[model samples]
Target: MTTLLPSLPPQSTLLTQASQVLMHNYSPAPLVLTHGNACTVWDAAGNAYLDFTAGIAVNTLGHAHPAIIEAINTQAQQLMHVSNLYATQPCIELATQLTQLGRFSKALFCNSGAEANEAAIKLARKWAKQHKHPHATQILVFGNAFHGRTLGALSLTPKEAYQVPFAPLMPSVKVGVFNQTENLDTLITNHTAMVMVEPIQGEGGVNVATPEFLQALRRRCDETKTVLWFDEIQCGMGRTGTLFAFEQVEGVLPDGVSLAKGLGGGFPIGAILVNEKLADTFQPGDHGTTFGGNPLACAVGLAVLNELTQPAFMATVRDCGSLLHEGLGQLQVDFPQLVVDVRGWGLMQGLALAEDQLAVGDLVTHARNAGLLLVGAGGNTVRLIPPLVVTPTEIHHALGLLRSILGGV
Candidate 1:
């Protein structure tokens, strides 16, 4: 048997040592980053990389923004985490801000996308049962969708590799084609609990649902009692140059929205906002969390909300997003063989490769060597979700790096 190791090892030696100590859950890249500044991170080796992944779209304001640091420091000095029984100003204010933007009646706080989704699933089933559609426990999800890794979310995930080993997933989940409205009609019936969708699917190769499709779903959900839930954990929080990607479409609002990632601006937080009619579905004893909605996380979440809601800030995202999209569009013209398609809304962008997934890896690794970090998804696509605060200069540089790599490929 391998000998046990200590936990206080140096950062340089941590990965190797931790591999033996910790559970093998994830296959992280071989870089041990020690610290970071806005839109950039430095490994223990002092190698710098422009962060295009943005902590998988978690660091919305980028690493260590001055305002974020100040908020966290001040909040920590005063209060970190108090029990949820005591209401904090930050928590109250954030709820107010979120509710103001939409028709959501109440916000239930949690600590991750998976947990928020779990809460949503439970709430949906309970609501359906109470409404007398007891058999309406089936949830309709899309192919190539990812909600989280928890059992409920994993059960909804379409990826086989993440689910086959963890068999015996929660039952009654039906899979449908994303952006295919006709298929949704066939799958969703009176027995369907809820129809969960991602406005701009982040992990599913950044596929943005057509406006017609979302409108169709919204109409159908309204007619039927099936709750319309949007898993905006990755595509929401101003990533699409708006508070939520659904806003991009006219007359399409979800009954509940599952949020995380950018909402806390790096601090771990998740929430599910339910409309007025469905808000009371859960009774007091129905659900609770020990660490969810703690003061520290709420404080950071408020800070992120405040900064992201600024009109000027959102305008910059729109401008920068357009520039990046146009730049990538131009690049696609020259390397048609390398780029099968380019899609995504705002900062949640992706490049579909003409070749196989292996070639996408080669291109991504080459990008890393050129001082840019990227993440890939299913369907041979590489995501380019840079920090929302990324400057045009950085975008141009990143594009140049991609050009060099694509030219070679």
Candidate 2:
């Protein structure tokens, strides 16, 4: 790959300008990233780092993938943004691909995971009003679940810190303990409009929902005529060695599924896939977005799906995931005092650190300083979400870096 470093202001000057202009919502790292290729990114100061974060598991093919870049450039030149009233080929084709892959009857495109989840909430309310009682509007979500940061999705997320600051969130929302199948009957009732959950909770410490628990939720939702939706924004699009995390569970098909993150590689796109039962819940004008299904985003999304759905892509994901998991497990064995647990499936793994021994943020910072990037999740866990196309050599190199960090600690 050719490297053409663009002329720019000093890193310190840029950081100061960003602090003055941008909001203080995020306390970002000091590095000013310039460009990337494969699994590595170069900062403005010409410092290269292995990107294990993969933009929080959004970069399906890593940086500067040929397919994604071609799609973006080609679609931008031909057609970019048009109103939702006008249909585009890329939008229609992308929807067809998603419905076919997910075995869902229909799809609604949006610009982000939060919007997809918000659409699901609206669809559930409308469906309940028409089918169930008028007051059947309660939504049931599990604890430690992160749907999104928007108001509707935030209400579903039970984290006190993220919720308390934005008080008086959406009403008619109920919380349940994740994987607690014993309380399904009490949690999901006739008045429940929808039951949304993450098959593998990403932000909530990479928690995996058991197959039995999902089976119970499916049965109860059927009995009460409630919609069971899976928020696959973080775990979908080959992140979990499958197209969707729910596929690994037996007889656990959801009524609806929300998707984003890796769907468009790095381009922003989200969608809501619904089964035949709830396919007709949303009418033509029920809900929409201005730039949801724009040609450029859909084109890039199609390119990403094309690459992910290749014959050997998923098998490679499984193999790489096993390798990564093995490395993490070895770390647990080597550093029993610091690494308390290693959990998660496929490439979306997490290393839970002992709070008494070390802080997750400290470990992440140490890794970053040592030319590796990592992200911290809930429960004092450090997420290792690398690109799906990462090679064995890269995985080993990352493990070596992590081992060095742990040894120093």
Candidate 3:
């Protein structure tokens, strides 16, 4: 069976072959990437694209960065995997660095954003059961939110497109309007175990949450004793200029934070950072994973985190992000019909198209053809989640290509 298939298909046939062989889950972009350099990827056809999407914001330091390559190579030469029974240096070091970043006192490593969110859900429920209320289990999730695809994470995701077939999800999950301060009061009851939200709504079209809203949530959670979980998978790890998006706001800290995407700089690692009190919920035998804290992944993650945490590195991100955001907003003034609004913070930006103007997928496909990789999000938005390492010059080049495409559209 293995020998029957071609080793690799040509550029023209790759998409078609993938359709026939792979599951009908993702509506992938048409470009078939052959290799990637810093902030740029080349298609098999030899066309280069300024990667604004950054593999959906996973490649924080950009593709094939020298530091990342070195870390991965050095770790591969030493050890790969050791069971949770024995502690590994990379994992211990990475966890210590993450713990120092904020009020989070402990870290639970996983392999993806979904897995991290799943761990958060379990920790939240377990904490509630043991410390707060034995019967408290309900969780409050926001509308248009995307946590992950796994069953437990899926339960927290409210999008119908991701939930329809997998009906009868985990019980006691409620949907609340985002940024609505009053809604939290109604949604959070004694039975609520946790209230989950993204600091800046990523899949929900880059909507920024007001500090008032977060402050309200913090107050409500304090009164109700509910665990507050912030899903920072897409927007964390310097994707939003800051190490975490919530850091920009005053009095906006969560009891638990789930992070992935950019944490490994494309090496694939996720984590749940818990406050000191909530850290004790998980006992030894309660939760575990075979590949969670492997040395290779932790080494890569450690490098990525170290690079992103530098003050000078984040200052560059802020400058670049400001340049990109202002450039796009100015374009909105010229092409008001094609673009309704441009909004976001740092490199995690988005352009919302006018109602009934054009499908978001069409814009994404057009950008790919023009050698600029972009991704679409909810509410007819085209997300511009470039790598944090992207420079002002790269942002200008990418936006210029987008402007050229917009003139034709």
**Candidate topping TM-score:** 2
Write model 1 residue lDDT over 71-169, tens digit each, in one string.
899999998988777888888877887877856789989999999999999999999877838798999999889998999999999899989999999
lDDT of 2 by residue, 177-252 (tens): 9999998899888789999999999999999999999999999999999999999999999999999999999999
Q: Indicate which candidate wins on lDDT.
A: 2
lDDT score for candidate 2 against the true structure: 0.93
Candidate 1 collision pairs: none
Candidate order, lDDT descending: 2, 3, 1
Per residue, candidate 3 scores C-alpha lDDT tens digits across 1-409 of 1121235567779878878999988877766777888888887666788889888889999988998999999999999889787899999999999878856899999899999999998899999998888999999988888899999999999988788899989999999988898767789988989999998888889887888988999899999999999999998998778888889989778999999999999998999999998989999889999889888999999999889877699889988989999999988998998899888889889999986877888888998888888888898999999888888888889889888888898
**Candidate 1 accuracy as TM-score:** 0.95
Position 239, candidate 3: lDDT: 78
Candidate 3 C-alpha error for residue 187, in Å: 1.0
Error of 1 at 250 (Å): 0.6
